[model samples]
Target: MNIAQSYEKPRWSADLCSCGDTGTCCITCLLPCITFGQIAEVVDEGGSSCVLHGCIYGALMVIQCHCLYSCLYRGKLRAKYRLPSEPCNDYCIHCCCEPCALCQEHAELKNRGLDPSKGWIGPPNAPPPMPPSMIK
Candidate 1:
């Protein structure tokens, strides 16, 4: 079997409700655009600007379907890290508790040493992101 198929994904470093970073949680609750934009910038590897994506997220909120957009990014993050759909699916999580999902995703990035606040500091020569794995 291929390594990808056999690899055991790591559990999210933070819980949906156990939000440890109150600052982020507040930002997510009050200004989700900022949080989502930050996350998108990193996830896209800076292919897109935070302001751009955040603005899009804010716009989608107007139609009350921002969850549609945000959930796609959640999918991207899960694909990148091989994360499981926990407690529920991405769309449901964002639809039911957008702020919580945003906070959890932000926490996930921080836990992986990729602080979204830094704004895509992925240097060209930096080591590639390491997926969770066993030492042996």
Candidate 2:
């Protein structure tokens, strides 16, 4: 059947408040953490408007203050300039939590006086190179 014929007596329409297109939960869940520009860009990318409760993304934003402390207190990935190491990232920004060779090398080099920007482990201006995607 053609698209129009299939929808002749549709269960829902985009105009309906309950319809998927008008969903606002993603924005609602990420409300306090994400900036306006970030939210707009994520929506523009066709991300689903529904956010699962207890999902990692939502959790990360929810306890941002605590996570920041945890990353510093537990992960111990902090800058040397501060006496009490400040949290570099809490939400796995730049895949900080994931296994990244560049980050590992950077961590090692951070002990030395050599600047990461002047090293071959990573590009002068880049944080680290992300791994390639795998096919199913």
Candidate 3:
């Protein structure tokens, strides 16, 4: 199936609040690189390794604004998911509230049935697996 044809209207899963998921909030608060890495891996369709992305994010944090780097993924995610650029533009949102933006993205992935911790959900066009009895 054509990827563009499968696109659904974008919508956020949860509001920007660390309070929504204590574990995610805590982890993100302490080590945003981990969260960002997971999101990047999923967003990139596992084309990049989580460790590599996380390290890059950490390095960016030291020398420059990592939010800028992360915001790029936000755009990719939005495009892939056909989500709207609501509240504000990706750059401004990340620049102003890095953690919240990260959390929101993470939540969005979870809501979409893609667990960032587990990595890519596979090709969006792939057919569902056949039931065991139905398979030859």
User: Per-residue lDDT for 15-127 in model 2, tens only?
Assistant: 11221211232332334222222222222222322232114334665654423422332232223222221124433532343212123323333333333323224323556
- Predicted structure 3, TM vs. truth: 0.80
lDDT string, candidate 3, 12-131, tens digits = 768765446678788888999999999999999879988999999999999868988999999999998888897899999888888898888998888887778777767555787688
The runs of at least 3 residues in candidate 2 whose Cα sits more than 4 Å from the true structure, single-residue gaps closed, are 1-70, 73-75, 82-88, 94-97, 105-136
Going through the candidates in the order shown, the clash numbers are: 0, 0, 1
Error of 3 at 115 (Å): 0.5
Candidate with the larger TM-score of 2 and 3: 3
Candidate 1 yields a Cα-based lDDT of 0.90
Misplaced by over 4 Å in model 3 are 1-9, 121-136
Model 2 whole-model lDDT (C-alpha atoms): 0.30
Instruction: Please tell me which predicted candidate would have the highest lDDT against the true structure.
Output: 1
What is the C-alpha lDDT profile of model 1 across 52-127, one tens digit per residue? 9999999999999899999999999999988889899999999998998999999998888888988998943597
